[model samples]
Target: MKQIGVLLSKNYKLLSVAAILEVFETVNKFYATAGDELPFELNLLASHETIENQKESFGYQLQSIKDVKQLDLILIPAFTSDNMHETLQANRLCVPHLISQYNNGASIGTFCTGAFLLGASGLLNGKIATTHVDASDGFAIAFPEVNLKADRTVTQDGRLYTSGGATSSFHLLLHLVQEFCGNEMAIKIAKVFAIDMDRDKQSYFSTFQPSRNHNDELVASAQQKIESNYHDVTTIEELIKDIPSSRRNIVRRFKQVTGITPIEYLQQTRIAAAKKLLERTGQQMTEIIFNSGYSDPKAFRKVFKKSVGMTPSQYREKFQVR
Candidate 1:
């Protein structure tokens, strides 16, 4: 049996761990039911301290990272905490272990924010990866060397794999199955799990929540202006008219603090407003477009489609209140 090690990282999400174990266990059971040898041995790997505390709770053989010298595959579960920086720090013990295992030819797959822990190991440097859609901005800012493809449902760079938020994890798992077993086994798993294998871009599921964790008052002032006036203007000059800082300074500091340019921020704010209206209102398309500060229907449709992966009518048809 090929060895599969699932790292129970600090603040690891219970559902993520459960899903990883269940999928592989099901795969193993499939072979056993067919009178063939089991294909995988699932190993719960964690730090020594965590192993002692969670061993009995997991009710499975838990191995410390120090004892796991070789693994054919490694799975990292998403973290529960919102502060991924602190969570990553808590899981620093896994960093060296991840690097060593990858060097030994073990493939690594990370689910949701679990990519943060893997990215911390420096193996993701220059590799395209995706994380939870909401965490994209933070991921990009934290690991500038890594190519962050926030819209992709899954990304594979050589042996390293990363998936987007939540249910997106299953797609990555199915992909691994395809890689190790075959496409037929992957299809069987998808059928058993009732997973729609058609998913690709994750953009449609994302809500544009701009960051508010910075202390720059000037940037704050610019943000307030943009949020308050996003519905009435298009140009950055018009949006930041009341802000005392020069346009150049505000743009630099705003991007520095928010990881997006002022124009991009304004577009996101407008799109957010439009999304809310689409979800909660019976407003006409024309009125919705006008209220969201777009003068041209074509431009609004273009931006909305690019940002949301659907047309305005399609978005409203799927999400509008009855």
Candidate 2:
């Protein structure tokens, strides 16, 4: 069993913390034994004993933050809200505590603006980190010490794992479950939650918009497109046509706003899809190749090996058949 310490604050985003808890619960169900030990030990720690009402700028309140020591993982979920004043104050309180946890050998992580807490803690200093896109420019200005990737959903740089937003918490947690436990366990939990066990950055969530605007409608639409059809043959030219932006302008804005090119984003999305297939299904390499949008088996092998540091076959043999 892994000990996960979650640090909570006043008005923290509930979904961020809830999503991670859901995954842990799924892990427990999958790993349950007949009259045996559970697979996870989650501790929710807060500054105070009283549970605080998390203001819903998005939705949900963080129920609590655990108080535990010698944790294997320390997760900082989304803030109560993204209000500058509120967030800065919340971050100030949480960052130092997270650092203390990390120094005690816990692997630190954050979801969305929670990355700001990690940034302020100095844990992400000189590390590649990601946070909510809306906070990109300001975060960059404030935490120039951290190499912030405005585009990525999650980044694992050393013992610190950082993700973008509330929904991205699912992907980040799935990634962690796969890393610590195994791909098989991760896939099982994902299936239990009715999520495609294989969805990743490459899988299509929705369409792409070129504008760097922080409007929720545009960002959500673009994210959905990326999540739903990341493997589509559609080009960036086609992606941005719906938006009032040019090709060069789109590319520049996307990189500046998200810290990645459209093509790179597409590839990562595809790779994430491949990871699910590799972990869950017993399909042959050729079958996974076709389903994940790779026309050629050799090409899929090359890309998969490069991204995951192992051949598709090897990944399955280690995680699936184990």
Candidate 3:
């Protein structure tokens, strides 16, 4: 049996931890009923002997292993924190243990913001990983060496694996099941859990909000203008007219500060506006297209699909407020 350790840390997302545990346990029960041997020995490992919910009112306790070595796979569930830096610093105790486990040939997998801990352990260095879309900008800034594939729902590089936001953890667990157990068993588990087996990307769920945390005032001003005037055919030349820098210099600086070209930013802004309109309003396609500053139906459809991983109609069907 493959030894699997699920790290239970303070401030961890309770539902994710519970879901993962329940899934593996159910699989074990399935194997027993079928007269087959267990495929995995799942354990809850932690830096502490006991972990309490940060919300003391909940009064829940988690029993954890003192030592987490000699594991085939280590799963880190997402932690709840607004400040990624502070979260990583507070969880520093797990860093050395995670590094040691990785060096010993154990694979590491993380769900949602738990990728921050994996990144802090230095295992994600130069490896493609992902996290919650809202946290993508922070993750990229915190770990520049790790290739952040924020659009992907799940990313597996050699022994390292990372999954996107919230319920995407189910997909990651399903993936692990498929890898360790056979396809037939994976399907059985999926049917048992009622998890969609075809979710492969997070692009449909992510909103493309350009990062504006940098100190570039010009870029910030340009972003504000684009956001407010996305319906207008605002050109880069028009944006740079009031700024002191040359068009080329402004474009270069904007790209440096925001990681996206001026045109790309505008496209994202328009798409974001279009998404909101589609979600809340009963606007026709022509009206939404015009309101989103797009005149050509073909061009709008192409950009919408490229950015959203689905057509406008599909996005509305999935996310529109009923």
Best by TM-score: 1
In candidate 2, residue 268 scores what lDDT?
65
Question: In angstroms, how far off is 32's CA in candidate 2?
Answer: 1.9
TM-score of 1: 0.97
Clashing pairs in model 1, backbone N/Cα/C closer than 3 A: none
Q: Rate the local accuracy (lDDT) of all candidates.
A: 0.90, 0.68, 0.84
> On residues 88-131, what C-alpha lDDT tens digit does candidate 3 reach at each position?
87778878888888889999999999999999888889999999
Descending-TM-score candidate ranking:
1, 3, 2
Candidate with the greatest lDDT versus the true structure = 1
For model 3, the superposed segments whose C-alpha errors exceed 4 Å read 49-66, 212-215
Q: Show pairs that collide, candidate 3.
A: none
Better of 2 and 3 by TM-score: 3
On residues 233-287, what C-alpha lDDT tens digit does candidate 2 reach at each position?
Answer: 6565555567655667666655555555666666767777877787788888778
lDDT of 3 at 81: 80
Error of 3 at 134 (Å): 2.0
